[model samples]
Target: MNVTDPKANLAALIKCPSVTPAEGGALGALTEMLSPLGFKVERSTETDENTPDIENLYARLGGEGPHLMFAGHTDVVPVGDEAAWTHPPFAAEIADGQMYGRGAVDMKGGIACFVAAAARYIEKHGKLPGSLSFLITGDEEADAVNGTIKLLERMAKAGETWDACLVGEPTNPDKLGEMIKIGRRGSISGWITVFGTQGHAAYPHLADNPLRGAVQLANALMEVPFDQGTDEFPPTNLEVTSIDTGNAATNVIPAAAKVVFNIRFNDLWTADSVKQEIITRLDKAARTGNLRGERPPVRYEIAWSIRPSHVFLTRDDKLISSLAGAVESVVGERPKLSTTGGTSDARFIKDYCPVVEFGLVGQTMHMVDERVALADLETLTQIYETFIERWFADART
Candidate 1:
């Protein structure tokens, strides 16, 4: 099948219900597309103790220097209330110029467009001037344990290296070329548990409520700003996702309370420094808080979530300018270079090489009817094709 048509490629991928860990034939479909284009495609299934084994693909064309990698995921979040969708989430149905599917915009659409772009480039030039590879994974929407991180490690260990990478995450908020992600904020999550005495509600004087200390600590984390906004990034922000007590009866004060929070920090701090800052705030709140009524530092403990994502920025001029120029040439406007979104697989890729992200509009991602416009898909294909030509040209010079 001719893979130059992005609409056709996206529809084939969308028809596979490749929800995390489920292969769902999405990788197989992708293989079919890349193989015919003369890509030496290799698929690996990575496994960890508890995470479901992941299916990842690395396909390379040409055996030369200045390798460029297009990174993205095939798996999608579960379709919530399948009945709520206008069309079946895996049907790849089209309605009024939009193609609706689970990964339509966040981001099977991106992968489809890139594949089509590569195919078109091959069709036009016969072969690329430099190496081009697709680093596709099936674990982005879940635990993420057995996906890109592992695939990258395996590839690097085998001596595979890339000069730069482009992540096909849904980056635009409203339009196709509105934004391009040059960096991402770091993320860390922790659970705080405070211990107290259980007692009757009427015995307030005798009972120590853990909820009081938990709220105090939670407030401290949010009340103070992490930092003023930076030039390349927004100010760090922390949110209390949940505060819970297992107590069933309102009259009985719970013996313990837990506060769950996640912080998105900027370049102003590293993961360790941000963690230290959090500890300082918690300690200060515990010592000075009146909620415990002089109860010896409001005993508490913290358990950090595993594998915090680190913050990073890409300063590769040629890579950024090539993509930016491509978008401007195709869309008639230079895209804004930004670092405003939550963390992504780009965070992992950044450690290996300079990385940036660009893709379809993200308004409907993870929504009831996630989708992409056909016109936007075509435009994105053009942008990717132009980027391919420009990146290789710039690398040669």
Candidate 2:
């Protein structure tokens, strides 16, 4: 019963085509591995209105203090151009001491390593002192509505609680033990529509050009710094991802212009405050930029994405120090505590418990031939195993 080997466990998970909302038997495979280790596994299917139902796994090995949860998504991103991959994305083929697959690094690999660690711990200790659980979701890559957020909600409704959580989302950028994410910047998107009048290009004076207003609005967002940046986070940045006039004919002035932008903000601002500030900026910019026209003010509409993630920081010295010690002991290097990456499942887990992220180097995640070095797999497994022992000891003390 050496279920604690990453090479076999990860290879099995990568073979599942569990792309986005698809199950591909990944959860079942996880249940099979976890159930043998005295974990009571529950498979839940969650759904949102107009979204596909997603299967999720929640397996717990014990029911005691210092409850530690391991959260990850079994779903993998779509393999873009199968023929371009050196090996089939789902084959889990090992070459040159590396295993190649779609979910090898971005996350199924993390799950496998954690599972291996837990299994090994139980085999050695005869009984795990405190609680250990796995919160595995199948809808992380696409619409996240049916995933961790809902799972946490269900757990809360049932009066379940966790002291802390670790999300396995491939935190390291280039090398193992390089970075550990303690926090992430908040994110929001804005949509703006600028109004104009239709006229011939030859009769430019007769038409109000909305393109000018769109440019001014976009510039208002980009040209100004949102803040000076906080101690744990960088300054906020608003990027204009798209602008469209929708005019096909070279002779006709378009009736409207549209611009879309996203903001990766730090803790200095909330989504609402950022929205208000942006509205103020756009209004001021439009009032000034539209004055050049004789027709009227720049009529426009603005909307925001309904779902927004807020910035969060974990101050749990016990959890941070425990994991850090494990990394140093296993990998021989102290990792950098960073808050530089985009959002992950950690955002949702943070609401329930203090959460941090650490995993394999993510250089190949989502690339053509996503892979994990054979050596890193064993190292990460050792790290997780050591963290489990130290974490329980620290909590008890």
Candidate whose TM-score is highest: 1
**What TM-score would every model get versus the actual structure?**
0.98, 0.97
Off by over 4 Å in 2: 290-295
Error of 2 at 299 (Å): 1.9
Q: For residues 1-397, could you state the per-residue lDDT of candidate 1 as single tens digits?
A: 7699999999999999998889999999999999989999999999999778898999999898789999999999999899999899999999999999999998899999999999999999996888999999988888788999999999999889999999999999989999999999999999999998899999977778999999999999999898997999999999999999988897998899999999999999999999999999999999996665667777899999799999999999999999999999999999999999887899899999999999999999999999999999999999999999999999899
Instruction: Please give the TM-score that candidate 1 achieves against the real structure.
Output: 0.98
Best by lDDT: 1
Error of 1 at 315 (Å): 0.2
lDDT of each: 0.94, 0.90
User: In angstroms, how far off is 246's CA in candidate 1?
Assistant: 1.9
